[model samples]
Target: MNHQGWGAPPDDKGATPFAYPEQPVGGFPGAAPGVPFGSEPGMPQPWNVTDSFAFAWNRIKADPGTIIGTMLLGYFISNLPSTIARFIPSDEPSDETSLIVTIVLALLGGLFSTFMMGGMTLFTLNVARGSFYRLNDIFQGGPFFLSILGANLLIGLGVMFGTMLLIVPGIIIALGLCLTTLIIVDRRCGAIEALQQSWRLMNGHKLNVFLWWLMAAVVSLVGILACCIGTIVTAPLLQIAFAFVYLKISGQTTADSVGA
Candidate 1:
């Protein structure tokens, strides 16, 4: 497979027809021919959740090692801050010092988790598009760091404000902006643009996306009920499913059309 640089998508001047501007570094996949942007002939009129989930399942089953391993590694590294904070030597530290350290660690953990989410999005997008992916693709989120971080902040504030107005608004905002990260990573757009695009994308499809989220929540709850070990499986499954949903909703060339 032909591989491009791992950082960011190539600039528009250098991008091939198959790639996005700034190469929206989701994963390091070689450019393959595909429908041009804005031309998703196979785009679903009303995407099927079952189909998305099935595509995710098939992809996972096809190569559990790369898919699961990359996700696991990203999760592990992202949580390292909290893991280390738990082991901090509390004996020698004053209460205030300990509290400060805990706050710092908590902040770091959130940032790491957000950063890893972007990386994972990249990897998952590769899978959704039937592009070659590697375990290291999870570390190529640096190019998307600012976009992801900004979007997160904006989404968080929007959700928080909406919650203050009423509980329903908060839920709506959360669902609407859920695809912000994927938009930013996939389109190389800034935070505001991605958030706007995501909001617009869900204009008439909120119910469908909500149902998908509900299904994911149930699966995750079941995984938790199954002694937490099941999360190791459910987590990656849902992640891949989400990528498929994003690709279909955004009218991009999905895994289903790779060789067609």
Candidate 2:
């Protein structure tokens, strides 16, 4: 699509493509691409929770109205599964039908949720990069919808099975695999490779990933507490924080830069 300046009229060419910055050899900023995270000496910390929040807060303030609105849109789309479940036909006095319907709807919701989440994520990343995007640009992730659905399912099952063995392993697996969705989006990799790359790429940094996840959860809780109105703000903040982290880990940001 033809890129335009802010406030310019829309063109038929849709969302402006923002190419991911190239790293030297490794995918991260200072390290060789394909190397494990944090392997290169003097490389920037790939998982700085502090910088993530700092960047998120600043980006949100820069475009409070648009960011919050996009986040709300994502949040609404992600909840459609529950809405569908509510409409499923139930056999009188039999809860089995309802249970089955719930699972089916949840699965479908989850599939759609990935696409919607990816759209919002692309939106946030564009914002972080200081590029222009329409409010509707979030839907641009539609192309990778099925890939994410499969990858998400595999990761979920893997994590679920791991968790069944013991809670610790499950959390570790979850954190390690958490970046799979982003990988699929940015790298244009398939479901299996994305999952593998995420697990391996995060090697030696699972604890930090857990920490970031914990922080994100806390922020989400705080947002929910704010009259259930703060989520639109905090949710996107968390996603942008992750986006910034992704850039940092991928070496798009300098050691001295937060990549905001």
Candidate 3:
């Protein structure tokens, strides 16, 4: 599956014909292939953080409608379990019943969250690439859907189990695995492979990623303070920022063709 849009001809007789564009830092195609693409080694690229935030902001500015629509969808999906549980006739249910309900709701939320992440990643990639996208893009499921969902499930489970051991460890693991959804969408990798790949990319960059995430969290808290209406704007910004982060850390460009 050529998802990068490199325009390489299809393989014949089991040949793998696609090649990653040689993108070296400070220069286009002819620079040394192994050199880091856009910054000095060991020095964090300015765009790595700023560009993501900028792109996210751009999307929000350009298409407030789509941003709000997608975010509402996300909120609904995330809160579905609680919504359903509210109607269930549980007047002072026993501890066991409450535990079961909580577990079920958590599981449902996790599953929906994975699908939403995958779909949102695809939508952002499309928008970044200058392709026409619609609100429905947030729900499109393709061959890669299950793989992406599975990867998210594994990551969610890891976070949950890790939390059982210690809360801080779980948060760290969750952040470390943050890129798995994007990896699955971008690389067409299986669940385990996506998790492994995310782990690798995040290995030395955990602190940086955490800082960025914290920044986003702070911004989001401010938005929440504005009576939740700010989420319509903040959600899109965060998504686009995430798309930017996906591009930087994974060396992917939305300009690249999906399934190239």
Candidate 4:
């Protein structure tokens, strides 16, 4: 409850021992504590994904409300169209109406997803850089929405298209484009550029990222198991963890960490 603000609202126990240096925004929580002794200060310096979980968790604890609230809202909106479509029984056996409903639902879902992801990407990017944001940050993604949507669409197409060829190729395509959104958010690049960059960045690192994903997935299942509220914490933590991955692979550094 004593957010120093949100590491689940900052406590002596949870404030990241590591520092993410940023100027305290006028209305947000005061600046984070100074960098811990071992803090590095340069690019390509990878933060350990596993160890950074504590830090990421602390970040979530700092502002669980905004983060969780935004997530819940996104979840609702994204699923609402489908939920509605499901209830709308096809009038005739032709199924054209049902097909239209399905198409509309898919489009709505895509829009909601783009909006949510843009916000999440922005949120994670801010946190990784040691900045705090207001709840509105969730909607702030509108600016990047187009790029995020396009990136996702393209990545999906690549994966699906490849899957049409072979399951193995599809899997490969998926892993390769995993970092596409991050690239778009950070570099503010176009979808194709981001996908290309993600593929390149993931080069020689897909296996490690996959391992990290598996580990996070297990943790995620734990949250899902907890009647899903646990996801309020785990979901953001996963995002932050991947942010670290992107930062490391791209040779970007947080406020204090540097590459050794």
Candidate 5:
């Protein structure tokens, strides 16, 4: 359980302790020897879409309780506002008070949803790195709240503006910024800094990310077809897969790379 360089070596059970950095850095600090940093902005780096999913699947199998339990709790709590809104009386369309309540609840849901996303992003990063994680890790994103919120807000506005110009720009912006929240939490960077870093990190890999996302979406759809219950597995699989890809592409030490 002793923290080594970036994280402790895997114990007998193949689990490492979670060790987040206290001070923010430009990227994941303390790279292990022989691990190459990612390519320059214009250079293409090899990426395997399936490998990321395989890594995620392995981790989920190793710790389904923490993975699935955290996801479920975050999902439930984030949606509470909307869930409660459904039970409120709404028989009249012109009810100003009811309308105001609905708007407020929706806003609350969105705020909680953003925070949960940040918390889950951090938790999943730990999972991807093969570190220990617990259900409470889902609520550990408070420290990065301002940065996360700012990054998300900027991304939303940029994407919206890009979409107004053309749909492709919006998609491109989204792909480029997909890892902003992760970067903010992982590197302790500000919103604009995280956005720029993500954009640079994703260089030459956006297509691969998009393709991987498409595959994940298909997997989720299949799970839904089997019955929504299957999402418990598929959902965490997606989260871990995303974290794995981010670690791999950004040259951070992952569970798979720890021993090697």
Candidate 6:
């Protein structure tokens, strides 16, 4: 009646159960499971301007498909309002009404940009962590998506309001808070948590972060110069690369950022 394999008995003295050790669930070895994966855990990764430039280059090479698609989509959407506004003619309304319409249109445009940015951030984080993600995953509506969009809008408004005070301060604030979207999207943090976390992680690396921001700005300028066509290819790439930079600087592995 013994069912044990040859050379072993089920209840023999000093016998150990035949069981395979569980594989690490979410992350790589030496890191906690059920978190996002890529960088070493528990240590804050530092990124400076140099890292930003390097990240940009890396992004261009890593996922060109996403980069190009996001860029093109952004360009087309951004220009649509302006094109429509042009056809409306300036003489159609009182000056105040026209101004209101213009402002509303601008707000709409800003919202569109925020949506695109949020989607791009998600995609970028996915790529950086070496996770498989589909384009539809970016657009799938969810609480996370709504949170990201709200956060982006708030941040964008802050930047705009700050700029009204002084251009330089606004630029600094914008850069300081640039990673908020990624933080929110990757960590599923609330609006305020993402903002605070971004500030905390960025404490010593502002200069380096600015450098990467500058590179992205430069690439963006190139897109502008190409009559917006260049963005069709660069937007998604830069976004994912930015995510990669966040991973490197934060030292967060894929599992740490994204749960299993």
Better of 1 and 6 by TM-score: 1
lDDT of 6 by residue, 117-142 (tens): 55556555655665555564444223
| Structural similarity to truth (TM-score) of each candidate | 0.84, 0.73, 0.68, 0.72, 0.82, 0.65
Better of 3 and 5 by lDDT: 5
Query: RMSD to native for every prediction?
Result: 5.8, 9.0, 8.9, 10.8, 8.1, 14.1
TM-score of 3: 0.68
What tens-digit string does per-residue lDDT give for candidate 3 at 139-252? 643434567666656777899999999999998898788887766655555667667767877777787788888889988998999998787778777877876676666654
State how far residue 148 of model 4 sits from its true place (Å). 2.4
> Model 5: which ten-residue window has the lowest total lDDT?
1-10
Per-prediction count of colliding residue pairs? 2, 9, 8, 19, 0, 20
How much does candidate 6 score in TM-score?
A: 0.65
Expressed as tens digits, the lDDT of each residue in 5-91 for candidate 5 is 221122232231332333232333333343322222233335588988898888888878878888888889889999999988987
Against the reference, the lDDT scores of all candidates come to 0.75, 0.66, 0.63, 0.64, 0.74, 0.58
lDDT of 4 at 195: 75
Per-residue CA lDDT of candidate 4, range 1-260, in tens? 11110111122312433222332332223222442211222245555657567667766676678766766665676577778877878878688978887898888877777777766776676666565555555655554566677677677888899999999898888989998787665654566667777788778777777788788989999999999988877877888777767767776554235211
Off by over 4 Å in 6: 1-41, 46-63, 74-83, 93-104, 149-172, 225-229, 254-260
Model 2 error, position 114 (Å): 2.5
Top-TM-score candidate index: 1
Ranking by lDDT: 1, 5, 2, 4, 3, 6
- Top candidate on lDDT is 1
The global Cα lDDT (0 to 1) of model 4 is 0.64
Q: Which is better, 3 or 6, measured by TM-score?
A: 3
